[model samples]
Target: MSGPKEPLTRESLEPVPIQVFDDHMVLRPPNRLKERSAKRARTDDGGDRTVISRAENALKLLSQEFDAWMTKELDRLEEARRTLASAPSDAAADRFYRSAHDLRGQAATFGFPIAGLIADGLCIVLERKSEISDPTPLIDFHVESIRAVVRQNVREPDDSIGLALVDRLAVMRERALPA
Candidate 1:
């Protein structure tokens, strides 16, 4: 042992800089296909014409069925609204929410973008549990507006009446929910 032990102090300590060793290595696997096959797979337009044609045909078939599907969804929403109006229960509320949410998701796909917007507004109104008190009238209005959009085939988001209806619904929702 030394004659006297020196007390360790900050001045006596040596500072060492941290060295971060990054072992990360990115490995990009090479393409295994032969060049001729790869070139043949892509068309001059940069897309496979056969795939594009198949997709278009599928879209046409879905479009042909879209009207019926939209009508079915609207009917389901209406039924749920009626159930909620008649008997306000958690199950009914959940059903109504599910129906409205389905419409919100599918309306645009069914070529009724305006209806989707209306469904979205209805969902917003219904989401605030604290604000919900006898919201049957508001629900009715939303259902009717959606029906009108589908009935008139208001597919364009920019349609004057559709825009006006959406704006009016927004005002109504704010008035009803107050936030």
Candidate 2:
């Protein structure tokens, strides 16, 4: 409705005052990509070697404690299984599922990927039923397989025994649960 608006210029624009709240802090996260790119540009190689070395060393240190952590988790899972066996209630089933679920999520990180697979199969079976009336023998098989894998240090996915156990469980799960 009015005449052509004037273009925005540095001199014409007035600075608005910003009030800082004492309770809340405003933070701007640094652009990590830009920082990484800058570091790469500054260095002769593509990226920083020291940072990668530090990360690898930290992972190695964590790996040293992984076996103990895995054992503790397995113990918890076994306890849950025992509880499920004795009680055979929804609550006990839930606890058992939770234990299996936790192991499924962390088994690979704990250097027992085969155990993770067995846990996954167990989770699938448990997930199929809301209230497990009688815990299936398949459940026992899965749990025992997980324990065996961890105990035997069967970390690799390609281990013949581990693969066979996983395959057998998969077939059992399919037969027990169906689609």
Candidate 3:
């Protein structure tokens, strides 16, 4: 058994050119871990399927999961709406904020990217007006816009209708702003 080898002399070393990447540049490298834990993220049990096929399957599965998540978020949105309607209070605002916050974070992941964008705007409005005073119309409008996005099944962020909804929400915020 060898204990240790002698260190290589400076003369034995060779200079190699190095490439510098910009801070914003990301480089993906090949995974050297177990086959199951590869970048493609396959099951531990080896499959006859090729990497490409596995990637396609993953996309299909992701769509299914996205639909499920969307459904759950919609339900939460409904519950929040009902709470705000039945009793317009800080607690109601808090409940709605929680649901809106979740949508703001995950809407894009579930297919409705615009919903997340609009939800963020709505959250800001709610944050400022913590207490639902006389003007509940703004709150209703923001909530309706979000519900419309879900009901219409808007997935693309650039859709004309989605853009309009976002615009209206922004205008409502503008109206709320004191001169």
User: Using lDDT as the measure, which candidate wins?
Assistant: 1
Worst 10 residues of 1 by lDDT: 27-36
Per-residue lDDT over 7-69 for candidate 1, one digit per residue giving the tens place of the 0 to 100 score: 544322444444455875454433333532465543456567777998988998879999999
How far residue 24's Cα lies from its native spot in candidate 1, in Å, is 16
Per-model clash counts, in order, read 0, 0, 0
Q: For candidate 3, lDDT tens digit of each residue in 63-170?
A: 888878887886887788788888878887788889989999998878899889888987877677744454567867777777788889988889998998898788
Q: lDDT of each model, Cα atoms only?
A: 0.85, 0.83, 0.77
Rate residue 16 of model 1 by lDDT. Answer: 41
For residue 121, give model 3's deviation from the true position in Å.
Answer: 1.6
The deviation in Å at residue 60 for candidate 1 is 2.0
Off by over 4 Å in 1: 1-53
**Model 2: residues with Cα > 4 Å off, grouped in runs:** 1-41, 44-53, 130-135
- Checking candidate 2 for backbone clashes, the offending pairs are none
Poorest lDDT segment (10 consecutive residues) of candidate 3: 27-36
Error of 3 at 178 (Å): 3.0
